[model samples]
Target: MTSPIQQPSRRAVLRMVAGAPLLLGASAALAVATSAPALAAQAGWRWCERCSGLWYSLNGTRGTCPAGNVFDGGHHSNGSGNYILKTVEDGGRGQGNWRWCGACQGLWYGGNPTLGYCPNRGATGHTPIGPYPTISSYYLIEDVGNRDSPGGQEQWRWCYKCAGMFFDGNTPGGSGRCPKDGYTHSVTGGSYVLRQVP
Candidate 1:
């Protein structure tokens, strides 16, 4: 992507194409009404919305660019499918790093903030948590036999020690224990605690 200064003036270029009013910060509809020359508005341009490094005038109602873009549409996002934007390429750090706002579903730049991605970016891991053989202190439920999702008839547990999953509550490949005999699962983060059933 081109840097802000290197970017061509939106108005100058637009005028050559269709003679749209160069609102000098004036929005096509709401472009700043400053009466500045179109070239000036395009020169010190700032983005209205944020994502994938795209920006538009703060004045206009939202709409897609001639180029196909998802956020360009008026519809806002929940930031479930967000990405990063930077003045620097290849995820590099610099004075301009953007964080996708899950609420606005837009990119916010100019803050030089810590780098982060939205949770919907698949940040969770699928690591095996526990195969606990004996009851756990944190959990307080009776153990029920393992259950499986539909379309199958099998369940597995993870051995916290061996760091492997085992079948039928076996301790094989695991060091974690199934709570004594009357425990239920109480999951936290990526781990589970066995709770005694009332």
Candidate 2:
């Protein structure tokens, strides 16, 4: 037979009253944790293992790589780390005038009068869609200092050799290909950090 239920002692009742705040605090903390927004990231940008340049990989065609002949004369993305580029829509913290080359599918700096080199489009420079000043659709990339934020992949630098952005992370394979110099890309200027898609 079950024992008769006994009323809680005064000490037990007092202890529960004291612990109520702790329970409420835990519940509030949990609600905040669940309500926080998840980190957002942009995708479709990738490192070309063959050309050492950053290229947009969302197209039906893989686009040309200076290294050449890897996959149907296109950029090789094998072993590439997926990168998320910050666009102008995100904020104005980064630089703009970065445009995608339709001819080669690589990112080129269009701020200068010179459009930069394009392997697929010959030495005449990359053939980007849209007119001068403001390209129809331009991409803005963030330039970061030595200290990178959480999930920010550093070691990306500008290649004076190709006038393109390439990954120079401590890759054992060495800096990827550079079409202009017909060799690995040479990093110059400050290091850039690209946000890695989590």
Candidate 3:
């Protein structure tokens, strides 16, 4: 009998060739597994040497993606706290929470973590006090050409059914406000004059 290696049968060789895909696929998967972490480090995906999984950084400096936190439209307050802001949807899981209108990018990197207020991306200060004609608190904003530095203006409004106040840093004066348009409040009589945030 000829040696198996020296005289391999055509059928055996064909089987080996047919199995090549499985072997190659396994090798490719292994390569990806070994290389993924490096890519995460190089490609700017969120990484936590201390963290277990994917994360985020506004300026690629810091942000956390904890195991319990959800990704889409959520936030990594500081390099740890995860607050999935609900502005994009209806009242964040119905708990009634609002997010600051600042750039979320800076909010994590430049986060004070001390103050009750957190700044958005690249923001150096808190919301300024100014005047406007209407506000929505949603509903984003559009300055076109104003002067607080760049953007436009912001403010908070009273909501009835939600029975709370939602701050709108995007829109100033709303087309309509609560009590002025049939919304109820506990106002004996108080006027909220425009006050600058000093």
Candidate 4:
């Protein structure tokens, strides 16, 4: 005698159908959570007016600023609003020096005070005491691909007297005269020499 074929009970089939939507929703949520961090790694920088701070965004989506205002993509400066927007190239590929400014409490480009003051503060003095414990720190960004030799890239430093950034490699031992302040500061060593690695 042949065995009779069996089917799923009607209740079992109905239970599975009822759970389908919940299963799909869970899967979607998992997908988003898993991908968020990866997206954030690739996101560039953004500036927020409300918080007067810089932020990062992934695929143009960012959380509300601390002050609850939206972020601005391009550079912007609003004196009345007391906010400014700027972007720093990812340190992945660049040749320059970064320094810590005690006055502005932020990192600045070049070794001198002349490359303009920090984002928050006005201009300050650039002394040649090899980075000062009171104000400046050593933050250098050297281009591995291009050394400061022959036809390679030149070393840069900030000049406080001139209030501008200057190439120090042109002079011997990275000691160059400031256009406005004359010969004073050395662009080689400073207080904290903090090196940033990519």
- Provide the overall lDDT of each model, using Cα atoms, as 2-decimal numbers: 0.24, 0.63, 0.25, 0.31
Winner on TM-score (2 vs 3)? 2
lDDT of 4 by residue, 29-148 (tens): 455444311121221323333333222222223422212323442222232121111112222223334433333222345543355432223234323222233322222334444322
TM-score of every candidate relative to the true structure: 0.17, 0.69, 0.17, 0.23
Model 2 lDDT, full chain set: 0.63
The candidate with the higher lDDT, 3 or 4, is 4
Which prediction has the highest lDDT against the true structure? 2
Model 2 alpha-carbon miss at residue 35, Å: 13
Shift in Å, residue 179, candidate 1 = 32
Q: Please list the residue runs of candidate 2 whose C-alpha ends up more than 4 Å from where it truly belongs after superposition.
A: 1-42, 130-149
Candidate 3 worst ten-residue window by lDDT? 36-45
- Candidate 2: give its CA RMSD in angstroms: 16.2
Q: What CA root-mean-square deviation does each model show from the true structure?
A: 23.8, 16.2, 23.5, 20.7
Per-residue lDDT of candidate 2, residues 116-184 (tens digit): 778886678876562233332333344554222444667777777567888887557568788887788
Give the Cα-based TM-score of candidate 4 against the true structure: 0.23
**In terms of TM-score, which candidate is strongest?**
2
List the candidate 1 regions with Cα displacement exceeding 4 Å.
1-10, 13-105, 108-113, 122-198
Evaluate residue 62 in candidate 3 and report its C-alpha lDDT on the 0 to 100 scale: 42
**Clash count list over all predictions:** 35, 0, 15, 13
lDDT computed for candidate 4? 0.31
